[model samples]
Target chain A: MAKKDDSPDGLKLDRRNFFKTTGLAGLAESIAAPAEAAAQSTPAAVGPGDVPVRLNVNGRQIDLMIEPRVTLLDALRTRANLTGNKKGCDRGACGACTMIVDGRPVYSCSTLAIEVQGKQIRNVDGLATGDRLHPVQQAFCEKDALMCGFCTPGFIMASVALLEKNPNATPEQIKKGLDGNICRCGTFSRIFEAVSSVKGGQRG
Target chain B: MKAFAYINPANEKEAVAALSPQVEQSMPLGGGQDLLARMKDYVTQPERLVNVKTALESTVTPVGGGLRIGAAMKMADVAEHPEILRMYPAISAAAIEVGTPQIRNQATVGGNLNQRPRCWYYRNEEFVCFKKGGDRCFSPQGENQFHAILGAGPSFIVHPSSLAVPMLAYGATFRLAGPKGERLVPAANYFTLPRQSLRMENVLAPDELLTHVILPAPGNVKSGHYEVRYKASHDWPIAFATVLIAMNGSVVKEAKVVMGAVAPVPWRSAEAEQALVGKSITEATAAAAAEAAMKNARPLSQNGYKVDVAKTAVKRAILRAAGIQTA
Candidate 1:
């Protein structure tokens, strides 16, 4: 065990000590008071507040009052209650927030809901018809391409877009096309197998 | 991200009128690929965001013998444009190396060219580096493996655009619209070094918006782009090069060699161009040009590998442009 130095006990100065001391709290409060006063002195211009933002998602009209800072991913998951798209790196690094907008896949997390008002938005939830699963979904289940199913939705959406563009994609194309999405469960081999199993294979 | 005002203008005039020269007061929203990321990280807090994609032109059209590309055109559309694929293959090749399919489909040309540097010290809000108005740069003393090797000064950030390198090689001219009206600037003069202004990367004013890029008609030139990346799919390249050479018979008449991801801006290597002109492009000429490209490089303590990688990029670009396959 290491012996503690007890000369002046300067180690006792911490968050607990700051709260216990009287003049220190006053010092902190006094320091924060000026910042608050400065903020009030110069108020930032604020408009385009929570307004009626409308988006056409999955062929359905959705109207909600949200702030301009709210992204399309938040609008889908929180306001519209469509949580099919996941918010994985809110920046554009990961593909977990991918969704088809105007027949092209885009990172929903990076897109502003206000900007995509009239564009078509499609998520993983819109793939199935009634109870029948999409062919890609069925293939994923058959090939066991998922473990915990966190990255499955994004992969499925990417696969749908890739096949629609190049149905007869070679192994090289498949490797390049789905490189955006990552699978933590190490199911890439199975996912590739599932994507290549679609019938009517031909490049569009 | 802090709450901000949003505006969608009816047309280009309205859009330009809505924007101000102050980046903090208002900013034009392109694809939001870079701006939204910075906002989420609390790096920039603009009070207003104006949607410019709705107002700007978003198509690529034929003009004269060359092509006129709208600044708002998506990277996917630009990469897949038939004429671009045939006439300017280097542009398409550079576009393909930007990001994955999702990013390409959403990111715009103006945004891609004008995106902020990807330096880790600058991207993270905790480090107040020189790029963010701080006094010192963290990369020179700290982790600097990915920093710039050429044209570096107080800041060591590598330019992050994939398209800018090829555009300079192709001799493209940019059209910008602002409160002072429109002006045409050559692509070579668009980018500036940190010595000029440490805050911004290019000549674009906060109130100005890039409208169009006009490429001169392709002459008797062979162009190619080659990028060397740690990851083949999505990672940014360690070094990349674009070469455009005009040949008379089997001898080179003129050449333009520009390297990216190894400098503060896209580096045009006049030394390499001098080595290539008036010589037949062979294994010897390509290797000589490759060596000459790195003659002026001043690599940092940790980024000497970039010099070797960039030399290989120049050699490969020349070989590929000359239709030679190197295993």
Candidate 2:
């Protein structure tokens, strides 16, 4: 409990008192008047310790106490009980952890949960409306676009985001759109067919 | 990733003020695609990370007959922007070729320019290479297949930036904001070689933020970007070239030839530019310029194949810039 290496409070407390005495803390409070000024507005830094994090995942609000080191994918899969997206490479290379944030597909494993607090997040869990599968999901099942089923959720999410944006995508564009996700079973040809065969457009 | 505090600053002034003097203690998070990956690998352990996405510039503006693009703008927007596609096609071409659709949507302009080398020795915790503050680099005697061919020394890791090639070819300048003030650094001097900077890749300090890239207007020049990759989809290039040639009718008046994924920095070849200065950009002239570009390339033991790949990229880049049919 006494060792400075044990807790971040050792350095945090010193920095807090130093800023308070110098009146620099007042300067930080006066100018930063934005909604994102939650942690910085207060004199104390948030954590290596647990702080409150409110996430909006798949149209449902889930609140939890998470450390800053927890990624968006980990927070969604572990605490929120939304485990549709798989973690393939954990790095940004593999797209198994892909999720749509504000109309763009992003690598959720590399993104911090705290940074995406105010953005609209949509994952594989939000896609299907009960028995009626999403167009991309229905296409995947019909065309057998998946073999292992591990990468299916991420692939479905990526395809949904792509087709919703460019519904009239050509074969080349479809190939480039879903290039992030890798089916180790090498079912790319069938995946391409599933994506391109969707008639009309996906607005969502 | 190590335990740290995260802060989303509302402005660049707040971002730099919150940074620690020690570079390793505090870092400015751009896209988090590069920094977070490094953090997860334990290659970088910062005590605090300041999110600069909303704080930095995020809009593109026309300035002094040139374009000033915000550093926080995503690569997806930059690749599809109509003005960028019309005015600077090479820049759009390079941006479009970056990772995947998902990566382009997430990666930022500043993040792409300031990314670290993709050397396996640097990423692995087992090998304490020069980039990790160790005494020696392990690439020279170790597995050297993807190592550098042109710039080889204490560290042989090629710079992992594709946008920097076209930025240097267009003679763009990066606006860097720091605690002191703001300063504009030329793209030619922005990236550093291993001997110049051992522990880091670029000249930016820990507290500084690259806000915008100001590109000068391309005056009657043809630009082309070409990259030779092992995979057609979502992979790092073996070698890439960006060639900008100012042509007077049919003869080349000026040329700027830069290559990426071949050295510790975005390598600009003066020999290739000199070879094409006074000649018409025909098939033979483009081949001669490409030959001159790879003349000084001394490959490592396992990377001799990269020399031919890089030479083909240079020749094809010249031919494409001249609007010639290149197969």
Candidate 3:
């Protein structure tokens, strides 16, 4: 038997209390407990004293208080109000929440909000200057690259990031690159045309 | 989805210490591609999330006749890596085959290797399959077209990682960090089948963290991957095969045959490998190996076609790697 630590608060810090206070009381009593308890305890909850998170979004530094579980999509859409990055699947399946993190386009929904505190984050909202749209966005609109337009922002942002990396990306590369973003309305042809047009312009 | 505390440690020591005895309600946050989705779907609910991204100590280096890929390295980074593309083209090909572009960008190599299965029963909150400690495996009779055709007994979920199959074929090893310190496990034994353990996929302890993957240098070995899917785009393959052949002037010296989406784990066909050894890769040999590979398959009624599909894929992949044309 393990010895218990006695405190002035009359709390016995034994395995039972340790398990109880940790929210594993039910699990601890289950068959999985003895095995899990032999291993190290899970991480503790976040306290209030954690440092403030400084998010660099679209080349601008913004400070906010976020819990550890807050995702980048939630931070961008809910806290920072950058709604251009839509949350379609929220599970990294649908690329509707795609954004550029430190020059690499990623699914913001699958990235923790606090992870990219110092890294630069570029969303669909960053593509426009006041009223003028980015070239990729312009081409997308001109070619009617969207039907329902829900997956357009993510596709456009992904295209911009892809074009930035491979200025002369082949159609096959474009196809592979855009494989992450899914448009439910089946506007793949127009989207491919828009991307190809952008590539052609860059070459000329 | 649930409220949780998060901590990002700067070093491995700090990470280990931070993971020390606490409230006992924690889970490590990796790429968050799978973990976050599980959380949102209520598959798992953890009160604390420890972020170990900053504590990555491994580096992608060409060390001692092998390339060490840091576990923290993103799938996109691995897919685009020059050395990786030049040496282990199959690995790069596998990395590119996983999920979609957004997933590849955010999903880490470690997370991909350690990700949970995408079985419909496991994904659905309603069905509590044998994997979830239920009495029966839902995949045995109900909607098992996507289930395994090899090394499956109690559970029939297919191994989800597209990279693991090729890694095993290339003789890769995983560098792991745990409470006892660092250790390495061969890719062949890294993934566990349902017969071995129904509850877990890999032999990772609760505290163990995969640090990197070490791939032996491609020395006179030719490797390739072939995946057959309904859609040509961002969909998991219905069946896939990865072949690594060691050749001496077109004569087979040795061969490693592995198949994905056809097994509870990455299925290694020793018989198929045996059939390839000591013989040149001919159309007849490839076909024979494919047949031998699926000889022990006890596929479900709905998934019976997978046996043929997987065999064809294995044959095609072997021929492609051996530079042989099959009419």
Candidate 4:
């Protein structure tokens, strides 16, 4: 048994204090080991490097260590665990990773994660209450706007953005506005119906 | 994806200073809707990524003579801008007709103007086309259905800038910031032919950043752009035309005809302009101008239809500009 250094007036020598002094140093060193290892592993400053980013995603402040290569889709799915944004084509062609960035609908798959640090990020996960679904989500379900449902979230988010921007959007505008998102299941007619119905329903 | 560094400068000077060294291996990111996708696809792997989105210096404002649209001004904002709608309606229309609403919302005007071509061979990683420093142009012998039928040489990829066509017609100029300072280049002369330089598109140097697009006062010219595409959605067109006409009582005084998706760069038809100038824009004249525009078209085996498409597009554009409905 190790002796405790009890120099205080009334404090008594205890085994707990003796063990804590020695073991606490080891625990602290172990806790700090990862950070030191990370710092040592990274290359020195040749140019500007990956910055620590703090973003407010879906009303939650998230701190993440992201490289310059990390896209918004990567940050959402990997770091924030918001997998509702599916990585479809991973290109700008398919809008599977659509999310409301600063009240505007954007393809998260093509957007850099660090670019959206301070902007408000709203994913499909933020579209529902405890037991109730959003009107667009409900409309998509009722209209059978999705077959595989892989592209459903993106379509739904795009619809919400469109309806919010132009509630009375004409059929031509609707077709033009939703031109970016692609559904491989060939449920575009139903998706259009769902969005158009929302426009009419909102006006009503 | 290879590991890369990131930078978010507060101002242009800091950003420029940060970008002093790695111009060749570094790239500035705007909305990242296009650049990041290209990076992820391994088409471009920059060692350092400069994030200039937060640099508030890039903003569109009504300036002295006309509108000074910032380089990072999103395409959606430009399309919906009231002043642009009033002055350059064709530019707004072209902006609206880009990829998609989401893309327009995120993609900057400068980025749109600076975007790479959408040719299938150019985009595909497997095929080593002429644009990628390969031996032969795949579109010549391979599937050249969407290839250019005019102003094409060593390469056949079409210019992808919709706003650029309208900008050229509107007499817009680009303001670029570089290692030296700010310099202006006419939008019409910004795009270079692949024959001139197969590896590059615009006249921008390695360290130069497109800062703003300066649209001259509308003056007395009536300009309009009309694109005829295969798909109404997010696809580039087969042929499009931008017509800027200066009329003197129903008779054309000066005409500028710029065609998009017709060549390696935006094809400006001086012959079409010459045919229209000092002449009334009648049905016969419109047809004549269209014929003059497509006279030099040398179509490939698959893209012979583009000649007719370009002619029809030119005719329709002239008619639309003249307020004469053909449909």
Candidate 5:
């Protein structure tokens, strides 16, 4: 791992050296004047630093103080105590970190928590009610669509988004829609069946 | 990933002000897909990150006869947009071929265009390649089955943008916003070669933001993109080609053929385009054009098969653009 010298002094020095080398010191100075004034005017505002971030998730507003580098996946799982989303390949090659953001399924691992503030974030944990599962979730359970169950949450989110986007999605559409999520147990046939079965509002 | 200061600029000017034009100290964050991955791998250690997603324009608006796609627009939205799908089908095809649905929902057009080459040698910290400010290109002497086959020299890394080839074939232009001012660059001159700059892939300065991709209206041109990948789903293509031909009744009036994953940049074959001019697209004509596309390919020892694969992609793209069924 790289030793992060991200201190304010270190960052300031880096910027100064960069400006010196790039011959942008004049422009940088002009821009920094107002920024420094704004910083002085604020009341202990921490930005470009770890601070409180509010997220409207599912239906509730959750607050967490985390560094800007923290991804939405980490913030959801570790900070908010919502662990339904799994981190498969953190670099976005895998879809295990899929979550619904404002009706669209995105790789939570790749999304920064600071970027999605005030957006309606949804995860697999929010799919089930007191005694009933979401229609898509119920479909998966009846069809035995998952074996390992690690990739199920992400698959469920993607399926929900797909169904919401195209209510009467064809088999080809289902295949293309769920192409992002990968089931390690090779349960694609059952998963497709489940998604297709629910497309017509079929119940278990 | 190392802890870094994140600045959320409310506008494009603030974002550009937060960025350093010459040095790589600060980087503009798009979807944070590519930047975060590199940060996690310790490949890039930027002291600060400027979040430009919120600052830049994220809407795809119609301008003149063409459509202007915001650099911050998600890949999924861009691929599914009605105008993009109807007018520029090749761009949508190429965008949909990128990684997967989740990735598409999160990735942005600017990020896709500026993504670093996924050369394993350059990605791995153990192997210091020329692209990574090292002495020599390890792919030239190391495992290079997935490396470039056409453009080889000091560096053999191929451009990894799926949308670039199609955009180039459509004669798209890019809009860049910087502290100085906003400027337009043609798609043809957007991507740079290894000889031009070893550290950067495109001509985007560090302080400049790739704001918009302006696609001129596709007038009388039928375009198609064909990609041949080892894995049909999420894997990058082994070779892909985007062909745009202006048809006059049954004959080709003008042609633009660009191949991806074959060179350092989007490899445009003037010879292939010349062969398609003033001729109908037949199996024989398509094959001849395809052959001309890769006639000067200098493949590495392990990537010799890519020459044929690229030619087949070119042939299929031409046939598809002409509405011919090769199967």
Candidate 6:
């Protein structure tokens, strides 16, 4: 981790000093501008510190005090104790951090928890009702769609959202809809079979 | 991500006011789709992140004959909007191909347009390349399979906006709002070249907020957008092309050909446009235009394959514009 300097702007404006530091001379004079807006710049800052945030997750409003930079995935996993969603490739490439927010799937790792307040956010933790697994989950279990099971929840959530939107999805739609999720277990053939055999899919 | 103060501004004016004059101080957040990722990677360390989702409008309103797409309008909505599909099919087509459905659902139109380059060297914090205030670009001497082949320079990073290619081909303008008020910049002029400024890709100043994308009326034009992605399961395209053909009954009255992921900007191929001006789009003509488009390509050591991929994209776009099947 970088030892971030306490400077508010993250850079020094002294032309000679910046030039000497970065060894960029000609661009220094043009780049260095005074912090003129710093005077009138007091907006309602939420946090470098933790602040109260309420999110409607799975059906209930879960509240927490998190830093402004805390991602939705981190907030849920670390605070709310919803660890069903995995954090594979937190950069939003892998679908392990996928979640459904307001009827559409999104990368939870890329979404800030504070920004998604009041949104109907659903994670894999809330999928089942008591002992009965969600149909997609049941299908995955029956079809043996997972090996390591690390990427299962994200795939299940993405599948649930996909099936909810298009219950009678065709094969092509199933392929396209579940494209965001990946199973490193190399159980894709079985995963596709599982999704395909779910019939009209499960309801929320 | 370095800890930062956050603000959810009430309106665009408030958001503009909240912006710091310096780029490093404050940043506008729409959906947190790109900004948060970069913050996590330590690529950009803004002192404050101003949530612009509520500040910027999300409506897609009819502007005379065309549409004015709000900066905060989600990509999922843009891809499915009836007006956009009917008038500017290329925009919708391009929008649908961005990342995956999840990313499209979360990422905004303006965010897509203003997103940073996906060059590996830029994304990896280990390498302090030119964009990171370092002296030289590492692409020329390093791994550059996905780097720019056309219009390369001190930095060989390709412009990563898929929408900008179709937007420029359709002749759109971006509305920028700032402390100094609002001004419109043409899509062609919105994206800056490597020579223009190595620090940033576009003309957007640190304080200005890209408010809306105003597209002029699309009248009697056939358009096609084709993208070649290495991973259909969600990855950036190898290269893509957008073609807008204004036909005079049978022959091409005018043509606008723009390609993405090929250069530092949504590169408009005047050579291809010139080739198609007075000719009907046929196997021969389209091939000729595609050939002309690649005539000046200066591919790097590893990205020579992209030139051929780009050629296929341009040719297929031409055929698709004419509503013909590609074999």
Question: Best lDDT goes to which candidate?
Answer: 6
**Model 5: DockQ score:** 0.33
Candidate 3 residue spans exceeding 4 A from truth: A1-51, A200-204, B20-25, B325-327
Question: Which pairs clash (backbone N, Cα, C closer than 3 Å) in model 1?
Answer: none
Query: How would you encode candidate 1's per-residue C-alpha lDDT over B1-327 as one tens digit per residue?
Result: 766887777567877887888855789888888899887777777879877787799998888888999989999888888998888889999998788898888889999999999999988888887777788888988899999998888788999999999998989999999998999999899998888878778899989999888988888789878999999877789999999999988899999999999998998999999999999989889999999999988888899999999999999999988988864
Better of 2 and 4 by DockQ: 2
TM-score on alpha carbons, each prediction: 0.90, 0.92, 0.87, 0.88, 0.90, 0.91
lDDT of each residue in A1-204, candidate 1, tens digit only: 113221223222233454455333353333321112112332323344655566788898777555677789877775565788887887878788888888777888889887788789899988988998888889999989999888888898888888878778788888888888888888999999999887543211
In angstroms and one decimal each, the interface RMSD of every candidate reads 12.0, 5.4, 10.6, 15.1, 4.5, 4.5
Per-residue error for A71 in candidate 1, Å, reads 1.1
Cα deviation of B126, candidate 3, in Å: 1.8
Candidate 4 lDDT, tens digit per residue, A48-85? 23345556788986665545466787666755557787
Better by TM-score, candidate 5 or 4: 5
Off by over 4 Å in 2: A1-44, A202-204
Predictions in order: lDDT: 0.83, 0.84, 0.78, 0.77, 0.84, 0.86
Task: Give the distance in Å from residue B323's predicted Cα in candidate 6 to where it truly belongs.
Answer: 1.1
Worst 10 residues of 3 chain A by lDDT: A30-39
- Give each model's clash number: 0, 0, 4, 0, 0, 0
Q: Measure candidate 5: CA RMSD.
A: 8.2
What lDDT score goes with residue B284 in model 1?
88
- lDDT tens readout by residue for model 3, B1-327: 555567666666556655543322466666788888887776666666667776774357998887998877888788889988889988888887778777777778888888888898988767877666677788876898888888888888999988998999988999878778888899988899887888779887666778889988778788868888888767789999899999977688999899999988888999999989888988899999999999899899799999989988899989988877643
lDDT of 4 by residue, B218-255 (tens): 77887757899878868788899999899998799999
Report the C-alpha lDDT of model 3 over A122-165, residue by residue, as the tens digit.
Answer: 99988888898888988888898998899988998889888988
Clash count for candidate 3 is 4
Who is ahead in TM-score, 2 or 5? 2
List the candidate 4 regions with Cα displacement exceeding 4 Å. Answer: A1-51, A199-204, B20-24, B56-58
- The all-Cα superposition gives candidate 6 an RMSD in Å to the true structure of 9.7
